[model samples]
Target: MSALWDLPDYDDHEVVHFVRDHASGLSAIIALHSTHLGPAAGGTRFWHYADKTNAVKDVLRLSRGMSYKNAMAGLPMGGGKAVILADEDRTKTPAMLAAFGDAVERLGGRYVTAEDVGISVADMQAVAERTSFVSGLPAEGDNAGGDPGPFTAFGIFLGIQAAAKFKLGRDSMDGVHVAIQGTGSVGGRLARLLAKDGAKLTLADIDADGANDLASELGAEIVSTDEIMQVECDVFSPNALGGVLDDASIAALRSPIVAGGANNQLARPEHGKLLAQREILYAPDYVINAGGIISVASEYFAKTENREVDVAEVRERIAEIPGRLVSIWEEAASSGRTSAEIADARAQELIGRG
Candidate 1:
């Protein structure tokens, strides 16, 4: 790989710490994009990468997205993310979690760690044993801190409704057909919420059995992972991973709108322009997925201050997601710039990068 600064995803990052604890086979990278809003806050993703450079790229892009996500969501937090390199079997261990926690603790509270991709609440609990700067612990009764997947799904659900109103002239998802491309935590919950709205659904996931089970519950159709993107639907929600909206994929989309909990949906900056050229309404991923970080930040801050978390407040903040998307869409319509560009500029301004 080139110098860290030369990486395309590197965006004037404040800090990038490469951590290794050979004793536990722990190797990770933590990237901090900004702290203008507050302490850099985001989740730690655990995944096995065939090419480790992709891991670097992921932390860089994801940390920056978290910065944008938090700023746009009006949170008093900046952006930071960590990626723990796993082996082919995706092995994880307590010692590794402890080492990672020690790494975060050494940051002197500049970085707050939580759960992401392969990391779980139990994993985070283990990490918290070594660091005070952690969140996503199981909720105290009636509190706002826990797995953020449902919250993220709720936000995406609302944002999709907003897009339908703005682009399809539909107030609700009553009869809308939405093709969802992941049956895991966020995507599955999103499917459930959309189902409650009486939407027609077609679902796909790398885990075929899981997808089939979810489809059974919702009376939805199941498609192969290869076919989900090309399904003729009003919305194509990519909730699995990023870089799915590259040139060829965007060219193949049949949906009028693309929105989901996936981060960095655009493979490159130009892809946003391509979406615009195709006249597809793209819901900037970070804005729609801010729900997770919102819950994490609230829990962390509330714990630090010895105060109770307000569940209603968290939902109220998530409720604003649709309005933000509407504003971005409106600006894109009026200025001829892509929604992604407008959202980036707005986030940059908020982080004092303007």
Candidate 2:
């Protein structure tokens, strides 16, 4: 097993906590990558992992990405992330969630938890039941806002448009072929948005039933996961797992642009350079998928003022994603650097000022 402290870029992390509750069968890790701007805030992800090392590494990388994501989104919060290692079907229970919430509360307000991947609004509500360090609750009374998935999908759609304009020199997604991997919450919403805009869709997901249903609803063609990346399309949108843009996968991609909701999409830092070398316009994942965090931050800020979240304001903030991507794309072209590197540098500068 690799030592957590020895991992590359491990020094960049501000704090890390390992929480275990044997009674509830809960084992989790929370990583706070930075708190220069404000308290660390990000989502809690629950997924079964093959080993503890991989889980810890994921939280570390994701938390760091959150730092960049938050900075680029212009949120005052820093970056932190939590991961619960357990089978969603068998080990997830109210007791487990509450235990996890207790762990979050122990961090004080330095870290806030929300919905991500294996976690949902309902699950966040369960976490909220145990502590105040949670968001994404239903809009019941003065509760913190609801799901941010749709907003995230909308942001990605807008970012894709910016990439298309930068690469294809067009302003519309009309008639553009897009292969989307993962038809879950965010991806599903994104597909609907793209289809409504008259974009051709090829959908893929591990959940065959759900993907097929979405495909039928949107008049899209369904492809297996293995074939999704190789599909002939103008854009390859990965809405599922991270590290899908590794050397092997990058070699097989036929798209001229890659933009989607997956965080930490590059397997390694060098992958960004490879994408740039290949002339594939890549929209940095953190910049594109920041709508969710933006929504969460809005709720957090509203709570400070003792008011309900302003959904309209949140939408307006998310609408800035495309413009931000355009700026980053232009800067990368002028600097002859990967978009990811440029984004990281800008984020670092922002964090430095804080």
- Please name the candidate that would achieve the greatest TM-score relative to the true structure: 1
TM-score of each: 0.99, 0.96
Alpha carbon lDDT of each predicted model: 0.95, 0.90
lDDT by residue (tens digit), candidate 2, 81-123: 9999986464688999999999999888999889998898989
Model 1 TM: 0.99
Residue 106 of model 2: what lDDT?
A: 88
For model 1, where is the 10-residue window of minimal lDDT?
Answer: 308-317
What TM-score does structure 2 among the candidates reach? 0.96
Off by over 4 Å in 2: 9-11, 88-90, 140-144
